[model samples]
Target chain A: MRRIFTVWTLLSVLVCASQAQSTGSSDSETIKELMQEIKELKTRVAVLEARQGQPAPEQAAAKPAEPVQETPSAEGQTLSPERISGIFPGIRMAGFGALSYKANDARPPEAGLLGFRSGNNDFAIGDVDLFLTSHLTSKASVLSEVVFSENSEKEFELDVERLLLKYDFNDYLKLSFGRYHTATSYYNSVFHHGQWLQTAADRPLVVEFSDHGGLLPSQGVGVSITGKIPSGSLGLNYIFEYGSSDIHRPNILDPNADEIVENNGHATTIGLFARPDWLQGLEVGGSFYHDRINPDGGPFHLGQSIGSAHVVYLTPRFEFLNEGFIIQHIIEETGQKLNTPAFYSLISEKLGAKWRPYFRYQYVNAPLQSPVFSDVQLRHGPSIGVRYDYNDYIAFKTQYDRTFRRQLPDINNLLLQLAFRF
Target chain B: MRRNWKSIIVFVALLSLGAGCVISAQSKEEDVAVIVNPQNSLESISSAELRKIFAGEKLSWNSNTPIFMVVRAPQAHERDILLSRVLKMTESEYKQYWVKKVYSGDVPREPLALLSNGMQLEAVRAEKGGIALISLADVRQGVKVLKVDGKQPGTAGYPLK
Candidate 1:
């Protein structure tokens, strides 16, 4: 019995020793981790302190453009870092700019059709866009986008593209009021004027802004409601918007007008989309927009209806976009009617990490007699491009476009662009 | 002598068992816990829900509180787990995704990134809708641990590790 007791005691001692060793090791690791964390905290505190103090001489020369740094309260209220962490994510800013060189072959009638004031082959500066958002309260925020775009006369013009006040009631109810991009199609809402944010150097022709000689009323001033529709794994959402349509109002003619155009008519748009859980990065949706057209040259008013459908598949490495639209107009006075159809399909693949090559085909068929889109009659062709991302913030893109137009020779254009985000 | 031999045998067997248990414990992978503010009423989150929240798709909670997401900076081990299992994205892809999302004007900003779990904890605790991921071994008081797919950390079938 003594022998057994002695063995058991030995075993207990060995076990205890092992456990003690393990516990000590764990404690050391924990202490090391704590020390690292404390170091990080100290660094953060130092940065904050520096910001609170007089600006250092070195900081004045070249300040880094931080990526969406955290801010205090939405009202520009200052608080201690400790107090601010939980309260509000104040104002966030992102900027995008691009520079492009374009060369195109044009006939006499279509001379300068590319909108390049410096002949058909020249260097041009694109939009310098700034996007800002301020979270006013827990459920409310304000979003504003201002762009400095180059005009046809080779001058920069300031434009306030969007100014919205948004409120969120829940997952099922979100409302925004003011100027916003019309959600008439998937691309218009997803890709803004930020060239760096888009895979291609330019937007597809069919979805481009009306100001850019595109077919759609891509911007509006009014209220938009969007929210998730509880469909359990179907991942459905809806958007409803009502505002003034800019169908016949192209801002290209007036670069100094910063005021939101209040066209003589109102537009209403409703859309539904689904992002299924099973197939990630896939979106299928459609929207219908109705409005009364007051074209600048034609009649006083015309009934207009636009129907759009889109299917997009996007991942980090691949992209597939297919969209179709039909615009119908009826002259209420003469009972005259016109229907215009447009479509675009884009496909791209990201090779490795930096290089992305893409192909797009687009078509637009608007009869020359159509009051709204007579200028954009029967344009169709393909654009192939390759984009090389120099880094996360910068990209270089080269594109070749071949456009076939009605009663006009096929036009060829090449664009080289450099886009960056800060 | 024979009885002493039997005791020795028993001692050896027990020691072997104890050593096996220790080895197993040491070899097991540490878990990553999905933590939120203690004031949050959520007790459980499905893997799908977790994915959506982290992906910035689900912006607000059921209570209408805007969800503030906090994540560890790049190269953190817990962040790797989050990128792979939760978001199914690489670090670069995640960054690109946020850039696109922010530039698209969908959300206000990207998720708040912190350099340390300690700071992450402080941020999550202070914000009512804050959520973060940290090592289970580093979990302290004052934060609620959410069950992913109905399984808690250190339990079988837990998705995050």
Candidate 2:
């Protein structure tokens, strides 16, 4: 990791030098001076680490961590780091994992032995995400996150999480266009994915499962405008998107079927959101998402409207977040109705520099009245988890969930994860 | 009678601790300012103009030269203080602002940051249209401080102190 940092620093300096030459200014000299200062900083850091008796850089490099990528513009005017450790624009990686013990003898003979499990072991690489951001020009740059999932082993997926072109109409309003993740839920807006390093292993189901599958509208190509209400405590932001949806089928049930529906069909979604941040660290917002999917006589018509509202309070040491969602799916011809209303809450506390323990509760009620389902039921659960942030890029996590349901034995699971980003 | 004395002692101790905490917290808070190159002369700047410069709207020095704004890293204390005081924005708000800017191709640079206070001053001095916040005690030559609302830091009319 240290070697990578050094290499990256040298490359950045070279890039900046070239840009400075092109701009024909004192930028090159500035770059040289900045490089010298960075060197001095390294020395000072080394001395401080030694004085503190901290582990050597080589030892620290052994851990799986997020790789911080720093990009210096060709013009030598800006220096943007992927994630800041102590400041913004710094890059970091975090990991999460869990283990549990389950009781095996409490179930019927036909059922598996795992019942009321006290210690059942399960481990995973929960979230591996790399975040790269830069302020390339005074008015523009980019923010991109690459996520790697171990559970599916699908390789790396580039979530252009936020690629926006913005023109500040003024301080009160800014217009943007490009691919960006919708600012739907309070938590979803800021580092929603597991690798972003949340205190909880599992987010509230309302915010987690509102969309098809477990993924939210992580990215959509569209235009959005955000601005603060002048002289008012309210901050308003709205987004309109018209493009292909991000939903994909992992595997086809029958590849050889005569009538097969291609997963690469057309879909569109529009979202509207509002947030008020007058109160420090506290944000209250709501969003509406309408999706239209046109499939070629597929099993599902793929038309749904989801409305959600969320409130979040973030403090230096503690956070309280809650979201409620209502999803209505409509069949193309039969007029069948599918309604799902859900709510979830998460309470997180920062135990210290490296440890954060959290508790989450989720309640989801799926009505069985739709043509797509034969059974309708409600599912709710409580999960307890902890996050160990070794630094900005690497973390260790463990979580246990006990789910309560009707006409079923309590369901419990444990997970251990090592999450990292590059 | 003995119990009353113990309670009084405990009460006094708690009050003193509370007072100590308030004082310590106040002392830790540092005042900052937005600075510019001494060669460029812009009279009193409005809140809206500051927002434009900080948001990368007005991207040039007073001389009509392309303005190159300098920003501290997001995690820097001075950066946070600058956002809250000048932009009146939170960390997330500021982040979103920059992210939008990057996507637009309007601005191609992220904020520049020095690991220490001394380095921050050096960077500002070397660059033009370079604006950053530093501790009031750390202000020095090479860079001139801009009045946020027509008033200097020590003046009672100062918008931000």
Candidate 3:
């Protein structure tokens, strides 16, 4: 009976072992399926993460997508409407600086009052100018130019060249009030304090700035109205001016003063210009100016008047400019009048695409005893210059000036200038 | 006949790549159109009036509505076409001219600039009296086309063309 019982126990153990093995196999299969499911889930998660990482698009447009060819658009900001669209507050700033080297033959005391290159022989900064302009409203604007210049005294002088506020009534009329360049000549009105716009390194002898022996009141504080002449195809324009200016003479009082303030003076001017539609780029203009100046109880309280005429033709290939003005200074104390006549003509031709060779002649005549006739009171000369544009923003100019003053030795000057515009 | 599984796989891959390319190419902007808001009563404009408007020489339209101009950015293809044809100015020249005008108080501000025709169209549609030059094909239903020189697009005398 013991042998039979042991045999039964062994068989029972074997059955149990078989059953455990089957259960383990099923568990292994379930574990394998779970591992495969986890792998698929991980792939889906990665895909979702990638999609989320991309940048969000802008608002969906409300219109149907059309079949339009797509190109890259510009990257910039459109900040506002016309009130201040492109620039902040509608302000624009631009300016220029220049360096010059010049030499001349003239002696002291007399030298400062005579030649073109009076105090210039070494490389020195000529002028640094700053221009600020702003649009205040649809009809109003403000512009000002301040300059730092190296004068004949070998010192820097700061000058407010022009400060003006302009108002536009319509397409045909514009009124400006403030200190501005007198509209006596085309060059004076167009090119104020910037040397970069000038063809020659230096202005003509008689057409220099007021402080530099120019006879006209180059700048005035006043009111001016300019407009188109409404002549259909005649292309006519007109400018009327009433202003106040202080005329000073170095030799008459203090030869060292940069400017003479005549204290009590007024000037009136009228100008007309015409450009025929048939012959484009050609303009003819003339001006009449009168001044009544009395300063400091001087015996010569002068009443001055000027009549001028001009002809100009400008093109990229060629340019011609001519101007002549008659200056009559009548002594308010006496009825005596001194006639000072001046004229300048210039012509330029563009060559080599970057070079402009220009020729200019200037003539001025003043009375022998006129106190205002200091430097070029009786001077006439021919100036030759060649200007080469290094690029759009920089230029190099070399000019030769032959100055002949009344009863004085003829002075010869050669000037080299490097000017930049920004 | 047995199908080649490898060839089928290659064909599918190329098809997907081509589809991706087409989708990307369709995402760009357009050529040129004279666009205005649908509410504007302007039907056509003469070439002279167009010149005066774009030049900032004139500010208001005939209806006394203050015209607001929306411009394409510089170097934009449509800008090149419109400026050369109507304004007779290069891109840089136009920019400089506008600078002078605004700083000189001629116009209170310059025209608005946008990158794409899509944006231009939206601006014209949203803003009353707004005008812009856009691509004709891309022009949708919200904006109206102004007849230039009394001629609409596709006509030989159209100024923008």
Highest TM-score model number: 1
TM-score of model number 2, chain B:
0.78
- Candidates 2 and 3 compared: the better one by DockQ is 3
Worst 10 residues of 1 chain A by lDDT: A68-77
lDDT of 3 by residue, B17-70 (tens): 998788655433233568876667888887766766777755655454556788
> In order, how many clashes per candidate?
0, 62, 5
Best by DockQ: 1
DockQ, each predicted model: 0.28, 0.07, 0.14
Give me the displacement of residue A321 in model 3, in angstroms.
2.0
lDDT of 1 by residue, A1-422 (tens): 89779878877987898799899989999998778857556645644553455344353232222121222111111223233342334577889888899887755423221235535687777688898888776677789999887865677778788999988887788899999999978999999888888888788877986666567888899999999999988999999999985544343212343322325378999999999999999999999999886666444467888899999999888999999999888888888888999999999999988999999999999988875565668888999999999988899999999989889778798999999989
Q: What is the C-alpha lDDT profile of model 3 across A358-413, one tens digit per residue? A: 99999988887664664446778999999997776788999999878767778787
What lDDT, from 0 to 1, does candidate 3 have? 0.68
Which rank order by DockQ, best down to worst? Answer: 1, 3, 2
Give the CA lDDT, 0 to 100, for residue A29 in model 1. 100
Give the range of the ten consecutive residues with the poorest summed lDDT in model 3 chain A: A71-80
Report the alpha-carbon TM-score of model 2 versus the true structure: 0.59
Reference-based lDDT, residue B138, model 3? 64
List model 2 lDDT by residue over A1-422, tens digit each. Answer: 88678767766976797687577647677887787667556634433433244333453333222221121111112111111111233332222222223222212211111111112332333334455554444344455544443322323333444455555544344566776555555555554454334566455544442221232444456666654444334545444445444543221112222222223233344344444434544666677766655444466665666677877886656778888877777776677767778778888887756677888888777665532221224667888888786665456777887766556466676655555433
Comparison by lDDT, 1 against 2, better one:
1
